[model samples]
Target: MTLVARIRALPADLDDLAGAAAAEGFGMLGVLAREWVAGTQRFAMPEEALFAARDGAGVLLGIGGVTRDPWAPALRMRRFYVRPPARGRGIGRALVAAALDHARGAGAAMVRLRAPAAAARFWEGCGFRPIDDPTATHGLEWPGRG
Candidate 1:
């Protein structure tokens, strides 16, 4: 109820959310933690960001991030995860929307993501069209792009 998405300044602060994700068989959160700790990635680019969704009580419901694609020109959405109990409540969508807004503010024209097959419908529902690229499974182009 009334989830708010906010940019996270440090990955270490996401330990609880990351642990929950790992328990649910998602490894991206762990990767986020390790990469951040190792200085390999921190979602610190001018056009990149990490967002966490929290309820009124400050409980983390989900987390996600955007970054310049390592293999493409578009910004890439990554490390997205929502707790099982929080699924279907729009928490994930809110996180995605926040990440998109962040990208749009940075003048990005497109966003890409490599979603699992199970999440195809979810991504599509958010306006990301299925793609046949190896580095990305779905993409969303900004409206009015010529």
Candidate 2:
């Protein structure tokens, strides 16, 4: 299957986005569902961007975004989730590449994410390393630093 990732405008349906998050065990109907729910305005900036992945038929395969990391001076890759049937198809990698590319273009020195334990391998495979801070859920720093 051919997957295309792009930095398009966010979908108007919050429910759909929430459903995608819920599929990955992230709760849907809550303030903690996704950062965009709480900080919708943050994504308006060009530096803070959102990307969506769709199949040739236009099915939503996955969604991810990059925004200012609240805990540090870095861009945070947020709400990354892929549909069950679309796993292991390089969609996640494509999304991460888009986010990192955006970060680099925005003059960010690093990128970070607090990914779940289930996605540790994926993040590690993408060249993100765990940080030493215990307060972080599970942090990964951008490996390609200047």
Candidate 3:
């Protein structure tokens, strides 16, 4: 099993993933980014990201992303997606591992995300706890890293 691959954000990757997002009922990141690109004072910061999982013949299989703000103590899980064919193969678990590693390396005090409600159970299974605070993004948080 190819277990993982790390592809940094490329413009083309953004285009390729639009279909995935739509199919899975997640936000269209390319549309968001394109709109952002068109806005004044908005710039793309190549996010600190990681992707892992198996490819047949020992290629990597997982997909995930993390954002690290150098001066801020927060880490944001930008996105995570596993190809439909790879589901149930532990690829999601592997991707989570890599994303968390990205967080830790970025000196994050905690990791946060606004996962679509459909992914609530999966993310909960990945160890993210729902927060009671309604104001927080998607009302969730990963326990603070010590």
Number of backbone collisions per candidate? 0, 0, 16
How does model 2 fare in lDDT? Answer: 0.71
lDDT of 3 at 33: 56
TM-score of each predicted structure versus truth: 0.91, 0.79, 0.67
lDDT of each: 0.86, 0.71, 0.59
Model 1 scores a C-alpha lDDT of 0.86
- lDDT-superior candidate, 2 or 3: 2
**CA deviation > 4 Å runs, candidate 3:** 11-17, 29-47, 52-54, 57-62, 69-73, 134-146
After aligning candidate 3 to the native by TM-score, how far in Å is the CA of 142 from where it should be? 8.1
The Cα error of candidate 1 at residue 97, in Å, is 0.7
lDDT of 1 by residue, 1-146 (tens): 65655564663457888888778788898898889889998888888898888778778778888999998888999999988889998988889999999999998888999998888999999999998899999999988742
Report the C-alpha lDDT of model 3 over 19-79, residue by residue, as the tens digit: 6666777664554456446752122344366564557764333356666433335566655
Candidate 2 per-residue C-alpha lDDT over 1-146 given as tens digits, one digit per residue, 9 for 90 to 100:
65655555555554675676666678622332344456644466777887778878877787777878778877788777777778889999998888888888888877778777888889989888887655354444444654
